[model samples]
Target: MPVDQETTARDGDTPDDLGSVQYAQTAVVPMDPAHLERHRVVAHQKAHPASWAFDVLRTQVLQKMDESGWRTLAVTSPSVESGKTVVAINLAISIAQQTNRTALLVDFDLRRPSVARSLGLNRPKSLNDFLDGHASLAEALVNPGIERFVVLPTNRPVNSASELLSSAKVGKLIKDLRERYSDRIVIFDLPPVLAADDVMSVLPRIDCVLMVVGSGVSTQTEVEEAMNRLSKANMLGVILNKDESPTQNAYY
Candidate 1:
């Protein structure tokens, strides 16, 4: 469906509109370029050389997804501090840069949600509110001054994340997001497969899964187990991150 009509860019929205609105009522909060830089989120920064890496990954991901006819992508890792969230964010930014695509990055790591902090977002309403029945999905979305990109961030942790993720409501949420809009890639940043049962709980609802593994952070056993758990999923390839072996940039 097309974005709601009469949706004008709100205050703090990026002036670089695509001559279209992806989210009519979504809050458009300008992201601080410096803060983004500090957090190593640079895919949207054309001048930053580091962005090229994400662009390449973006191309490969898009190609695979298009070929497989997949719509929802779940990104996770073997363990914590594997930089899965960072990869997901940059990939979303790169995808959003495409003239024909819009990107929706959803923070589904309910136990330790960090997409908002990683993106320098501090707002009132978020995924927590939506799950708690206090806010609508549209009200929980935020455009971080990046045209064609919106974020559904979770501001707090939920103790019953695994149960909630597998519930009918969460399934409906994923289905709605996947089928609602045209040319929109919905990326869900999920908890690690080894971290909890959360990833497995939500895996079946997602179309495909991407694993991000930090070179020195994840153990062979952990990686193997995670892959085993995801053996039934439509694998979207694994990302090797945080390895300094590569020249200058270490993330894929």
Candidate 2:
């Protein structure tokens, strides 16, 4: 994969920019006071009667993961713009609000990362950067005004995003996060499974793969095809987005 060089600006560097770099890195950024309001808004946007379904879904996921001893999780869909990022982010936020538990949101969608942007944080160094050795984990993680919750945003789109995600370094990164944040939840916002093999490559590393299917859009055939490509089936589940049926709510 082609790599870019990291650049740090002078004292008067632009507030909106974080210099130029080849690959993104994971860093520990202090939480800003303003992040609290942003967190509330994010939480509020996710808070709905439909959200109760996710609360139930979360319990089910935890039950399955607990039985299998899985920690890391990958949230994805079959196509782009399927609300996977929003589901993953909201789920992570809800998990973080569990009193003493922590939650870490890892934006693994190098193709189009927007987790940090949505949370009002600067674009961050990504898993690709950390795995490629362009930056350290401590340099990429940020606090978006929530206690015990952190985000690792993908800073730039790299040509070899797929290869980087499938690399051993990415595996090691997941392991390290689980260890360091043993008290926290690690949620990975992955690229769409059908968009690339990135989601499939990282599935085995996670405890479960939550597949978000757009209601009235995703066909059963497409979902079956994607499921067939997966190595494990027990860690898989379907999340229907924007369904009209009472049994098929948005959270499920």
Q: Write the per-residue lDDT of candidate 1 for residues 28-52, one digit (tens) a residue.
A: 8888888887777989878887788
Every candidate's lDDT = 0.83, 0.64
> Pick by lDDT: which candidate is best?
1
Q: Which lDDT value does model 1 have at 7? A: 43
Q: Identify the runs in model 1 with alpha carbons over 4 angstroms from their true place.
A: 1-23, 244-252
RMSD of each: 6.5, 9.1
Q: What is the lDDT of residue 229 in candidate 1?
A: 96
- Scanning candidate 2 in windows of ten residues, the lowest lDDT window is 1-10
What are the per-residue Cα lDDT tens digits for candidate 2 across 50-163?
455555666777767667766788888877766677678767766766536667889989888877766666644555565667865545656555556667788777667788
Error of 1 at 115 (Å): 0.4
- Root-mean-square deviation of Cα positions for candidate 2 versus the true structure, in angstroms: 9.1
Candidate 2 regions with alpha-carbon error over 4 angstroms: 1-41, 44-53, 123-128, 231-233, 243-252
